[model samples]
Target: MTNVVIVGAGPTGLTLACGLARQGVAVRVLERATAHADGSRGKTLNPRSLEIFADLGLAGELAAVGRTHLPFRKYFEGVFVNETEPFAGARRSATIPYPASRWLQQPQLEALLRERLAALGVTVELGADLVDVRQDADGAEAVLADGRRIAAGYLVGCDGGRSTVRKLLGIPFVGEGDPEPVMVCGDVEVEGLDPGAWHQWFGPQGAFMLCPFEGSPRWQLQASPETAADGTMVPPSLESFQRLADTHTGREDIRLGNATWLSTWRVNVRMAERYREGRVLLAGDCAHVHPTAGGLGMNTGIQDSWNLAWKLGHVVRGLAGPALLDTYQEERLPIAAWTLDVTSAGMAAVVKGIDTPGIGVEVGGVGDFTGLSLGYRWSSLAAGTPAGGDPGALLRAGDRAPDGPCPGPDGAPGRLFERFAGDDFTLLVLGAGTRPDLAGLPGHVRPVRVEDRDGEVRRAYGVTGEALVLVRPDNHIALVTPATEPGPVHAYLARLGATG
Candidate 1:
C-alpha cells in the first residue's frame, strides 16, 4: 500500500506528490492523460502560490521560468489600465519572505512540478485513469482502467471539473452560476499586434482578451460572447489566423502564425458541497471550479494542494490526528467559495461594466486585486475571527499566507519565512510575548519573531489587528491572540497529535 494515491497529474497532483514525497511519504500519482497537458489555460501564479513554491525550494527555479507583471498590463476597451508595481518597499519590510506573484504559463508550471517530483523519485503513472474507488476505515482502493488495484492510506482527486473520482465517490457539486456563456479560447502566434500588453475589446462586438506567451512573447487570444459554446475550432493556419486577427483587432495587414491549439468552452463558478467523504478528498477543480476572470483556477488549486499535502503527511506519519485533516475542508472551502464569488463577480462586472464601488478602479500598486492576501477565519483550527469566530483566531488556520520578504537572523536580511520554508510546522509569533513559551515545543515546530516589520505578518494573514499569530504546516494562520499564552497554543498542538 502506498502512503497516498493521487488522481490527476496536473499542477495540484504533482505539487501534492512532490510535497509528500519530500517528507519521505510514498506517493503514487495516476494520470489519465498519456502525458502532461500542453494547454495554456491557466497563466498566472498569485503571490501565495509563489510562496508555497519558495517553501518547497523551487522558488528560484519557478522564477527562472516565470515573467513578472503580466497582471499589471491589463486593459479596458483596447486601452491600458493598470499594471502591478515592483513590491520593493513592502517586500523590503515584510515579516514573512517571498515575491507577491509571478506570471508563468500553465504548461511550463506543470512541467516544472513534474520535474521536481521526478527528482524526488516520485514519477506519475501516465495513461492510468481511475475507473472506480472503494474506501473503508483501513484504506482506500483505486481500480484503474486496466483493472489494476492500488491501495493507499488516502486518496485525493485533483482531476479537472469532470472528476471521475468525485463521481465514483458520489459527491455532488452543488452550485452553478454561469451567466455569460460564449467563449473563444485559443493559443496562437500573431504578428503586428503588440505582444507586450493584454488587450480587451469590450464594446458591442463582444469581449476579447489577448495575453502574451513566454516564447517570442507572442499573444494568446481569449474572447467570449454573451453565450457559451461547446464546439472546437481547428487550429488556424497562419493565413487563417491573420484574417481573423484583421477582423478582430482591425489590423488588416497583420500576419498571424499558425495556432498551436484552439478551442472554446464556457466558464463556471461552482464547487463541491464538501471536500471529503470517507477516506477520499478533492482538490483543485474537483473540489471547486471558479471563473477564469482572475485566472484563479490553477493558483487556487496549487494552494489547495499546499494546504492538504502537509496535513496528509502528518496524519499518515502519525504526527498529527485525523481531525487535523478535517481542518483542510474547513479552511479551504471558504477560500474556494470566496474565489468563486469574486471571480464570478469580476467576470460579471466586466461583462456588464458594473463598477465595483470603493474597491478602486486600477489593478496595480494599491488598486490591484491581490489574490495572494486571502486568509481564513472560520474553522476549528482558527479560533475567533469573524469568518471562523473565536475558534478561527489563528490567522486563517489551514489557509495560505501571502508573501513578503523579511530580515534574517544574520546581519544581512532574509525572508521572515526562511525558517519555516523546510516543509515543517511553523509557529509565527508577532511579538516577544509568546516566543519563549512556544519555544522548545518540538522539532517540527519552529517559532519566529515578527518584529522587524509591523503589519507584515498581519497583512500576510489578512488580520487587520492582531499581535500574536500561529501558522499551520500549510502556511495558513491557525491562531491569533492579543496576548500569547501557552494554554491555547498547547491545545492547538495537542489537537494535531503533537506531544510535549
Candidate 2:
C-alpha cells in the first residue's frame, strides 16, 4: 500500500507527489485521462509559485522556458488606447527576491513537473479513472474504473473542476455562474500580429484578447461574442475566432490560422464547503473553481498541494498527529474564498467598464497576485506576537519568511532561503545568542545559527536582539520569539505533535 494516492496528474497532484517523495514518503498518482493534458489555459506563474519551484529545484528550468516582461496592449474601436506592463515596475527587494511573473504554457509547466516526478521514480497512472472512494479511520481505498481497489493512508483529489472525488465525498460546491458574456478560448496561430505584446480589443461588439504563449508559435485566443442567438454560445473553431477578431477589431488584415486546442468557458464561481472529509481531501479545481481573470486558478492549486504536502508528510512519518492535517483546509479554504471574490469582482468590473483590460483586476497590487502576500495568520500552527517597537517591523508568525542575505557557515555571505531549501523546519537564530538546544528538537527540525553581522537578517526579521524564527517546511514563519524564551517555540511544535 502506498503512503498516499493522488488523483489527477495535473500540476497539483504532480507537485504533491514530488514533495512527498523527496521527503522519502511513498506516493502514487492517478490520472483519468488516457494522456497528458495540453493547452495554455493557465500560463501565468505568479512569483510566489516561482519561489516554491525554486525550493523544489525547478525555478531555473521554469525561468529558462518561460516568458517575462511582456506588455499588455489595449485597443478600443480599432484605435490604440494604451499599453502597460503591470510587472515592469516590479523590482527585486532584499526580502522579496522574485518580483516578476512568468508565462509558460500549462502543458509545458506540467511537463516540467512530470519530468521531475519521473526522476523521483514515480509515474502517473494514466487512463486509470477514479470511480469511487471510501475511507475508514486507518486509511482510504479508491475504486478505479477497471475495478481495481487501491488503498492508501490518504487520498487527494487534484482532478479538475468536475472532481469525481468531491462528488463522491458529497461536499457542497455552492456558488453562482454568470449567465451572460460567455468566452471562447483556445490556442491558435495568427498572421500579421506581433508576438511581443498581449493584444486586447474592446469595442461596441465585444472583447477579444490574444496573449503570446512562450516557447510556441501559438497564441492564446480569448473572445466574447457580440451576439449569441437566444444567449447560445458558438462552438469554438478557427472561423468563429476569425469572425470574433474581425468583428471586435474591425480589421480584416489579421488572419487566424490553425488551432491546436479550443474550448468555451463560462463564469462558474464555486468553492467546496470543506477541503477534507476524513482521510480523503481535495486540491486544485477539485476544491475551488473561479473565473480566470487573475490567472490564479492553477497557481492557487499549486500552492494548495505545496501547503498540504508538508503536513501530510509529517503525519505519514508519525512526527505529527492526524489532526495536523486539518490545517490544510483551515489555512487554504479562506484563501480559496478570498480568491473567488477577487476574481468575481474583477469580472464585474470588466462588465461595468469600471476597470481597464488587464489592469486593476488583481486581488491587491501586482505583489498580491504573486502569492507572496498570502499568509496563514489565523492558522492553528502559527503562534507568536510581534515584538513591537520598530515601526518598520513586519515579520510575524504565520507570515512568509522573508529572504535576505546572511552569514554563511564560514562567515561568508549566504541567503536565508538557502537555509530553508529542504523539507525540514528551519530555526533561524539571529544575533549572538545561546543556540537553542537542538538535542531535544525533533529530527524534522533543522537549526542554523546565523550571525547578524550586518544587521541584514535582523532587519528582515524585525529583530533588534537575539531571536529565533521557526520557519515551517513550506517556508512560512510558524513561530517568532526572543531566544531567551524558547518556550513558545517548543510549545507550538508540541501542539502539532512535532516534538519527539
Candidate 3:
C-alpha cells in the first residue's frame, strides 16, 4: 500500500506527490483524464507561489518559460483608453526575492511539476477515475471506475469542482452562484492584434479580454456573454468566439482561428465545510471554488498542497502525531473563505466595467496580490514572538520566513532559503557568538549560524543583537525568541509532537 493516494493529477495533487516523495514517502496519483490538459486555464503564479517554486528548485525553469512583466491595455470600442502595469515598479528586496507574479499556462506549470515528481520515481496513473472512497481507522480505500480497490494511509482530493472523493466523503460545498453575465473562456489563435500587451475591450455588448500566452502564438480569450432570460449559456465554439470578438471590439478585421480549448465559466463562489473527513481530505478546487478574477484559484491550491505536505510527511514518518494533520484544515479554511470574498468583489467590479487591477481593488495594494501578506499567525503551531521587539515588526512567528543572502559554513555566499529546501525544520542563529547548545534539538532540525556581518538578515527579521528563528519545513516562522531563552523553542516543537 502506498503511503498516500492523491486523486486528480492537477498542480495541487502533483505538488503534494512531489513533496511527499522527496521525503521518502510513497505516493500514488490517480487522474481521470487519459492525457494531460492543454490551454492556459490559470496563467498567473503569484509571488508567494513563486517563492514556493523557488524552494522546489523550479523557479528558474518556470521563469525561463514564463513572461514576468505584461502591462494591461484597455480599449473602448477599438479606441485606446488607458494602460496600466499591474506589476510595474515592483522590485526585489533582500527579504522578498521574487516580488513579481509570473505568467505561465496551467498546462505548462503542471508539466514542470510532473517532471519533478518523475525525478523522485513517481508517476501519475492516468485513466484511473475514482468512483468512491471509504475510510476506516487503519486506512482508506479508493474504488476506481474499473472496480479496482487501492488502499493508502491517507487520501487527498485535488480533483476539480466536480470532485468524486469529496462527494463520497459527504462534504458540503456551500456558496452562491451568479446566474447572469456568464463568461466564455478559451485559447485561440488570432490575427490583427499585437502580442505586446494584455488587450481589453469595453463596449455596449460587453467586456472581452485577450491576453497573449507566453512563448506561444495563441492567446487566452475571455468575454462576458449577454444576459439570457432563462440564464442559458451558448456552448463554446470557434464561431461563437469570433462573433464575440467582433461584436465587442467593433473590428471584423481581427480574425480568430484555430481554437484549442473552450469553456463557459460562471461566478460560483463556494468552500467545503471541512477540508478533511477522517483519513480522506480535500485540497484545491475540491475544497474551495472561487471566481477567476484574482487568479487565486490555482495559486491557492498550490499553497494548500505545500502547507499540507510537510505535516503529512512528519506524521507519516512518525516524527509528529496524527493530530498535526488537523492543523491543515484549521489554517487553510479561513484563507480560502477570504480569497473567495476578495475574488468575488473583483468579479463584481469586472461586471461593472470598473477595470479593476489584478488582485482586487478593495485590497490595499499590489503587494496583496503577491500573497506575501498571507500568514497563519493564529495557528496553534506558531508560538512566541521575539522578546523586547516591536509588536508591529514585519517578521512574526506565523509569517513567512523571508529570504536573504547569508554566508555558508565554508565562508561561501549562500541564501537563507537553501536551508529550507529540504523536508526539515531550519533554525537560524543570527549573531557572532558560538552556536547555542543544540544537543536537545531534534534530528529533524538543522541549525545554521549566520554571522550577520552587515545586519541585513537582522534588519529583515527585525532582530537586535542575537536571536533564534525557527522556520518550519514549509518556510513559515514557527517560533521566535531570544537566544538566551531556548525553552520556548522546545516547547513549541513539543506542542506539534516534533520532538521524538
Residue pairs in collision within model 3: none
Instruction: Give me the displacement of residue 498 in model 3, in angstroms.
Output: 2.2
- Per-residue lDDT of candidate 1, residues 1-500 (tens digit): 89899999988998899889988999999999897777687877867677788778788888787576543344443444445444434452343344455666788888888888889998889999789999899899999889899999999999989999998888888786555445666677666666655555444455555677655544676664322155544333444445445554565555656576566566676789899997899999999986666667788888889889998998898888888788789888988988877777766656565132112112212222445457655567765442223443443543455445555656466565666676666666664333445544767777666563455555555554435556676766676555434466667777778875
* TM-score, model 1 to reference: 0.83
lDDT of each: 0.69, 0.84, 0.85
Candidate 3 per-residue lDDT over residues 1-500, each given as its tens digit:
98999999999998888889999999999999998888789988999999888888797789788788987888776677777787798898878888888988899999999999999999999999889898899899999989999999999999988899888888899998877547888899989988888888876566788889767988999887644468676677898888888777788789999987888887789999999998988999999998877678898999999999999999999989999999999899989988988887776766665343232122323126788889898888878565455677767887888899887879998899887798999988888883666678889998889898788988888888788889999999988778877788888888878785
Question: Top model by lDDT, which number?
Answer: 3
415 Cα displacement, candidate 3 (Å):
1.1
Ranking by lDDT: 3, 2, 1
- The Cα RMSD of model 1 versus the native structure comes to 5.1
> By the lDDT metric, which is better: model 1 or model 3?
3
TM-score against truth, every candidate: 0.83, 0.95, 0.95
